[model samples]
Target: MNPSLRNALTRLAFMLVAAAAALPAAANIDIQHWVAPNGARVYFVESRVLPILDVQVDFDAGAARDPAGKSGVASMTQSLLDTGAGGLDEDTLAERFTDLGAQLGGVADNDRAGLSLRTLSSARERDGSLALLRTLLTQPEFPAAVLDREKARAISGLREADTKPDAIGSKRFARALYGDHPYGRTPTIESVTAISRDDLVAHYRTHYVASRAVVSIVGDVTREQAEAIAVQLTGDLPQGEPLAPIPAVTLPQASTENIAHPANQSHIFVGQPALQRGDLDFFPLQVGNYILGGGGFVSRLTKEVREKRGYAYSVYSYFNPQRQLGAFQIGLQTERSQAAAALKVVDETLAAFMAKGPTEDELRAAKRNLVDGFSLRLDSNRKLLDSLAVIGFYGLPLDWLKKFPERAEAVTAAQVKDAFQRRLSADNIVRVIVAGD
Candidate 1:
């Protein structure tokens, strides 16, 4: 090889290495926020890596706000929103979505109803997908035929779910925890069957209002284009009064109930309703829960219930805070013969943790794992978009993500013990064990 040629190659390689070293670290996520002229909240983040667009429209219409005797109305209403809209029938709407190569979806949980769309970023695809979203949000047809079919499906699902021991335990657990609250009532087959097209239409018109919706958009689009899309999608939505406020969730009085079931394994749901979105105790509780159960194989529950005694394959606990007070549930399934022993161990562990709290080593490991694992939560545009939506919907601070690590690291052992003692009382916890000896 000539000396000149060899020297040139070495220079090129050195330059490439220098350039790579100069590149910035990848922890930054650029989020943009604005309010639409029509009063809808909009959040956007542009990413050109993927030639796709993801949009979600969320409303305050959740099951907790359902009226008496209409336990499933919120979910049913959300389902029918996109089934038939504007002048399109269900079949036509589905065909159009498929033809455009777009996916339309809906999700209904205890605290919100959401409709989402994912489409290619091409102009034709974006416009077509947005048009369908507009119809679903504004001009849902709620045709009589589609309503009947959906009702039948819901009822059939309920009937099938009733036969399973896990299902029975969950249904009874919710009822026992929530009592007469809307959150406690699972939709009955009869109640679902009674829901009609008019009922859904009325529910949509009342709750799916523009002022109540939060629009989240992420992907291959500019801020200007995202604003136009948001308006075009939600402009025609009814401008109605804000939804009626959800009443505070009252934590039920403490009690233990063991229901008889024929299943060979017992299902247990134990805990109480605790915490909400902006609660001050959230960070401490979250960190403590990691030590208690949410941290997979490293969690105390797993160590006690599975590794030590082999009583169950898995055991977990989590604090699900929502618009109102949410449940802090610990659950496991074990052979009926071993259920009592398993429950005893679980209670002992929980009681000991509450009284003494996690040790220094446990707290350090929990913080390390949570902080180190935070990057994976925001690695994709879709995940970032979802986080932005939750922040917007729950009115969390714009810097919530940035502050998460600091909060986790700041949690003291005394604070965890104090928070747990204040938030959870073993004597006041609700214990439901199904098919236990």
Candidate 2:
């Protein structure tokens, strides 16, 4: 969630709304699919239970697509989409949505850029808000002044992040793990401030084209309406070429980067680029990650580092599968003096798990938690929209949701051990320690 939205939602968390429950078998919910005349792929799920609608438009334009010397173009383009569009300025756009009781936002990340709208299903509200959404999509102004303002804001944020040890360690970890891979590049103050309106226009024209779009709708609408919505969103898009696939990520050789900082606690990170989204090894790694470090109190790393030695308050690890090989990162912050001990314990815990695999009890518990909690993933329109966007964007199996729990259940201890052993070599791990002696 965006920080602004998070704060807004935090306040709304106390408000009581009519409670609704998803189907008992949320995983088995149907997803309708089609392609628009303009070459945009569309996915939809009709949930007439609520008189509401959620529509999202996604393109294969993310940070990884940023051109050399223009590291923040993708993000800036997404942000500026809502700044002004059609004939409306940011304030006018805000007023339009507010009048209609609609929520609007844009999301940009490593593999996708998206704009989303949530509105009441009545024709008066839905039709108008969606029309405004189309204008934002097809006619973003990228006003010169807004571009300058956003660039300055981004640079200011980056400058603050630069001073934080955790942020320093994370950025260094990416560079070390990816070397020259596109996944490694992030906006620096120099790069972000260097961006201009021309750069935003060029990137938007190239990357936000029709051929590269996925229009996802989850709401109380009919098939005819969904098709119309999809076309309205992408038909006017520039027919620029779809992005060429990102280059494959190569594993980094074992290395360590230790940076000195004036912080009381050291921030440490470990691991390397591990798996992409549709890999066969995903199941084993997902289940195995739980027992190894993703399960909180039950995880081996937490048990060894916090429960036994009290080196850190919390420790965790997980795989971030992306368009290319994302990372399998383990991260923790500890008192600078105890950083060494915490890191040693983390390594030992990982090594032991890789050698022996998770215990049967741990495997059962992990599977149970993942399976039992699967329904929550589809419990809301927003959550369903997320899944649809990912599926449409990544070209995953249409029945991926149905197969998710089955795959997790099928993963045994031996399979997990083998997957981890083959996919990760402790020898090739890259380590980053900030402010630790």
Candidate 3:
């Protein structure tokens, strides 16, 4: 086949798949899971509807896993995977993916870090992409020149972020909420400067091992093919022991900080550490949060602060469930003069919602919205791949997508209220304001 013609076909197929993905899909997500011989957990979803395949391999190597005093190591390590792998430099690596019409990506967060790939499922493209991924997994070079260049770039970026009000408020809010926990630590110039090429190699060798890997594959592939891909990707990795679990989050005492900034608007963040992944309360919390603030204009927070009082352009709240206890944050920006008044309304709204919970009608509407829109979540192979990665990495049930709506519908008003009351308190939430009066 002519190379140009093959590339065009790949593009057309990807476009067709994307168009099909825009429609609602069946809620029944059948995930076939197994553990590879090398101890890598694998999750597979076979979808022959599209010619594209998506794969994500996650490991317990996110920010929380960064060595003490090396806050940026995990992110840097993941970023540099394709910079130099299997004797190929970064530019050559990029050319290979381009020529194959495949996409290579990376993921980094507080709890997990790894890579993802999208490619045509034909044997040539599929096999080629997987080979490159395998090389990244088992043979990243961590070249010294690339490390120093990236370090300088990261430090420059961090310095620029320090001057922004929203960034300052966010870092301050995290510090206030998580205190000395690793979750609170964001990369600073000092920390990034402290990291060395040796740190990246050590972090990868310690955390990016076969035993800790969760490989999630979705798209046009058979079970046998998927099994082979999983093994081929992880088989060469060292079967090192999983690292110790990240420390559990503890609630910090409530405190209010008003940082002086020259910005015209005040950036405000308020909340506390709340739920973790797989918590039963997620259903109630998810349902209730929509009524409280997650819903757009209809939410209580938006109605109170943005609609009635017009104190801010927008206000929203959410519960971020993570591998460890995550944040329940309400965030907004308003005129500096009205910041305190807006915050007062926010506090009152949160307190009332905790005390009374969502009304019966609110509960019904929330459930209706959530359940009705659930199909869209699984409509795409990429989305399915994300769901698979989460399920495999977190050890969630295979039927999680299938049963999501049922569980959401089962949440009652009383349950939402109870969950909120138990999980949040007015006294313990941290409040941080930048440029407030």
Q: Which candidate is the best by TM-score?
A: 3
Clashes of each: 0, 0, 0
Least accurate stretch of 10 residues (summed lDDT) in model 1? Answer: 19-28
Residue 401 local lDDT, model 1: 77
- Model 3, total clashes: 0
Error of 2 at 188 (Å): 0.6
lDDT of 2: 0.87
Candidate 3, 1-437: lDDT as tens digits: 46884867867677876678553354656789999999999999888877789999999999998887779999999999999999999999998888788899879999999999999888888999999999998999999999999999998999999989999999999999998899999899989999998899999999999999999999889999999999999999999985677898889998999999999999999999999989999999999999999998989999999999999889999999898899999999999999999999999999999999998889999999999988877778888888889989999989888889999999999999999999998778999999998
> Cα miss at 72, model 3 (Å)?
0.6
Task: Identify the superior model by TM-score, candidate 1 or candidate 2.
Answer: 2
Please identify model 2 stretches exceeding 4 Å from their true place.
1-19, 22-24
lDDT of 1 by residue, 1-437 (tens): 45753564466457445544332113455667888988889988787766678899998887875667877889988888877778888888888887777788876888889798887788887899889888888887877877778888888889998888789889888988888877788888877867776777777888788887899998889998999998998888877785667778887888989988888999999999888898889989999999999998999999999999999999999999888888899999999999989999999999999999999999999999988888677765556777878887888877777788888889998998998999898656998988888
Tens-digit lDDT string for candidate 2 (1-437): 45754554444343214435533255666888988988899998888766778999998889988989889889999999989998899999998887777899777988899799998788988999999999999999999988888888888899999999988888899999998788899889988978988888988888888988899998889999999999888899987775578999888999878899999999999998999988999999999999888989988888899899988898999999998999999999999998888898888888888899988999999999888888788777778888888888888888888888888999999999998998889778999999998
Name the lDDT of candidate 1: 0.84
